[model samples]
Target: MAAIIAADHVSKWYGQVIGLNDVTLTVPPGITGLLGPNGAGKSTFMKLVTGQLKASKGAVTVLGEPIWGNPSLYFRIGFCPEQDAFYDRMTGLEWVTALVRLNGATEAEAAAMANRALDYVDLADAAGKKIGAYSKGMRQRVKMAQALAHDPELLILDEPLGGMDPIARRKTIRLIKEWGRSGKSVLVSSHILHEIESMTSNILLVNQGRILAEGNIHQIRDLIDEHPHTVYVKADQTRALARAFLSEDDVLSMKFEDGAVIVQTARPDTFYARLTALAASGELGAIHEVTSPDDNLQAVFEYLVKS
Candidate 1:
């Protein structure tokens, strides 16, 4: 797939301060999660891609055109910034319609688009409510509405899930997946690992202004050998499995759950190998399923950032 956003040796500095280092990446069409903690240059990269900041070195292009100072390219791009800035006095309907008008839609067309976007975000009922009166979550929905109202090819969202409730978060995650399935590209940035993880398996892990890792979350977690990996297994004979697992010295501990066992081991490969052999013997009954619960961005962060 061709890249919608491309950055090669891109760096950004605020005077003597560095916001991003020599970071190179290509974002193809689809939903790609930008995973990193705060102050990790995620925002800086978003700004550069959205044409909000000029790169200090190298180049950045979106849709085969330079991002810097190219206001026209924004017609094909939708941006939801990290900040909470808003027109306090304007209603959600007014605010979203104003933004849609920037896309050259007629007032009537913009109003219709605004309503459609508000409905997509499940905020149609509150479209007439003033921004100052709306809760943080509602305001976030308004921001989302404006981004989708234009129906851009690429949606660039910065910490969009911040301040959302669990239900709203789930809805937003589903929305992102829906957008990707519709064949549009989305670049979403979040400091929370699980938040990004729920949105897409494809991730760009950034830390200290550099691209640290990219690809499946589990693949990245596998690279961290310093921590114990936790795997959950469901089996017909739980007691038999526990007895066998407890004998393995490499397994640090074991926890019993309803019809399942959670095992922590420093050597995952050996543990998996043993499980395969034991399952083949039929002494432990049938092993229904095996999964690594911590095979995610949290494991990678615990190793890369927390360690």
Candidate 2:
């Protein structure tokens, strides 16, 4: 499949600090989440793709064409910047219409496109409301609407769900999922693991200005499975559970705590499934909780860094 975006040995630096260090990645059609914590060069990579910033070394391409200083690429690309800055004087409709018109649409066409985009984001009711009067979620939807006004083939969203209530976040996630299912190239950057997990399995993980991992999240999980995983079980009888887990060959270590038993295992799913079956058989009574202590994006990132 043809890639919608490709970065080849892309590196960016400012003085002594590196922004992106020889990172290479490809984003194909469909939803691909860029997972990273803040200051992980996610924003810098986004800027490089949008031609807002130049890389000190290497190159980035959008839709097979180089992105830097390429205004022509804007016709097929939409970007929802992470910045909170916006013009408060204009109404939501006015704001989006202006951007659409700038992309070569006629004034009447811009109005039609803006209205359609607003309706898609469920912001039609607030079309006339000034941006200053809008809440954070409303502003987010307005930003989304502006990005979609041109109906671009590739949508680059940076922190799209930031500062939204649960309901708004749910709605936005659904919209992005739908867009991905329709086969548009959508690359969304987020620090939240579950947020990205809920959207798509295709992911690019970054940490400290470098690409750490890229592929199905399950592949990364498999790699971690080779390493020992810490599992925590909270229950009324910690000692009893710890004793039971120690008998298994997969369990590398066990310890008891305040009403809980923490076990280290080389095989997490197998161990967890066995424990579940044991509970069902009345062998472990009234099991309160079972969680993978090592099953998190931070842990995964740290494990890769150490490797």
Candidate 3:
């Protein structure tokens, strides 16, 4: 399938600072997660795709058209920016209606579209309330409402779930998934790994203004698993549990803390199998919990970067 968005050797710089460096990738139809930490060029890439900023070098295209200087393309794309840019005095409905009007909708049409969008984001009840009076989550939802009001083919959501309450976040994730199911394309950026994982398995891992890895989340997890994994085991007989793993060749090192044994293993699968056997045999006493500190995005990125 042809790409919905494509970047060819893209790089963006601000004076001496580099925002994105020689990045090339294609976002296919449906939802694709842009995963990165703060200042990792996710926003720069988003801006480039959305036509907010011209690339200092290379090219970016959306829907087979160049993004920069493309006014007509705005009608086909919806953007929810990371930064909060709002008219605090304006009511949510009024703000969204004004934005939809920019797409050349009539006043009545804009208001109707805005109302539908607000309802989608669960902000319809607060549509008449001033934006300034809304809570952080409400403000976030209002931004989302404006983005969806136009009913664009592609959605560029930059931290759309940020500042949202847990319930709101889940609802927003479900909505994005529903959009993907409806065959609309979405490129959503977020620093939180589980948030992105919840929405889509396809991801682009970015760091230091570069594309580190891009593929199915399971593939990335497999790559991360090749690195040494740190697993914490809390048990009644921690020393006995630690002793059981000491004989294993895959076990690199072990330490004890707070009634838990921290085990570093090169082969986590092997280590886990052995752990399961020991627990089942009732030789290591009662196993309270087994947790891996290296199961997060930061650890995954660190392992990937180092490798």
Candidate 4:
């Protein structure tokens, strides 16, 4: 597959501080989650791609054209920034229409595009309301609407789900997923791993202004599979179960606490499945709760960032 965006030895700095260091990457079509905590240079990378800022060294190309200072690229790319800046007094329709017009669309075309973008974001009913009166979620959706107004080939969403309610976040995730499936290249950035996890398994992990890892999340999961996962199990039998788990090769370590057992294992799903089967078959009785430390993205990211 042809890469929509490519970076080679991309390095950026703000005087004494580094933003991205010797980073090289290729972003293919479909949804790619930009995974990193705050100050991880994710924003810098986005700016580099959108031509918002020039790279201190190296180069970035979007759609085979260098992104820096290229006005024409704006027609083929849409950006939803992390900042919450919006026209407080202007209605959503007015704001989006204004941006669409700035993209070189005629008044009628801009209005039609604005309406379609508003509808896509489920903000058509609130299009006439002042942005100041809109809720945070509404504001987020408005930002998304503005990004979608131009109908760009690439959608770069930086923390699009921030400040949204869970239901709204879910809807946004679904929307991005559908867009990716429909052949649009969607690159979304979020510090929250579960948010990125729910959107797409393809991730570009960044930390401390560098790319820590990139590729399928399951592959990264496999990379960390060797590390023992702390699985907490609360059951009626504590010592007996702990003893049983200690005898198994899959269970690397075990500890007893509060009438429950915390077992460390390399394969959580396998261990969990076996444990459940044992309990179901009247071998291990009365299991209550089972939780794995490696099941969440935060833990996995922490490990990778440290590595």
Minimal lDDT window, size 10, model 4: 289-298
Task: Assess every candidate by TM-score.
Answer: 0.75, 0.75, 0.76, 0.75
Q: What is the alpha-carbon RMSD of candidate 3 to the true structure?
A: 9.4
lDDT of 4 by residue, 55-106 (tens): 9999999988999988988899999998989879999999999999999899
Per-residue C-alpha lDDT of model 2 across residues 1-307, encoded as one tens digit per residue? 9988999999999889899999988888899999886778899999998899988999899999999988999999999998877889999999999999999999999999999999999999999999999977788889999998898998999988776644566678899998888778789998755567668898999888999888787766566566776766666667777788878899998887787788888876677566656666656664555544314446667777677
After superposition of all CA atoms, the RMSD between model 4 and the true structure is 9.5
Candidate 2 wrongly placed segments (more than 4 Å): 219-300, 303-307
Q: Report lDDT (Cα) of residue 265, candidate 4.
A: 81
Best-performing candidate as measured by lDDT? 3
Report residue 163 deviation for candidate 4 (angstroms).
Answer: 0.7
Candidate 3 accuracy as lDDT? 0.85
lDDT of 2 at 301: 71
- For residues 208-292, write the lDDT of model 3, one tens digit per residue: 8999888786866576456677777777898877778888889989999998899988766677556766666776686655555
lDDT of 1 at 51: 90
| Candidate 4 TM-score to native | 0.75
lDDT of 1 by residue, 1-307 (tens): 7998899999999999899999888988899999876677899999999999999999999989998989999899999998999999999999999989989999999999999999999999999989999877777889999999989899999988765643455577789889999999999997655457667888998877889888776755355445676777777887888899888888888998988888888776677668867776778787755655424335556566554
Q: Which of candidates 3 and 4 is the stronger one according to TM-score?
A: 3
Question: Candidate 4's error at 106, in angstroms?
Answer: 1.5
Model 1's alpha-carbon lDDT is 0.83
Candidate 2 clash pair list: none
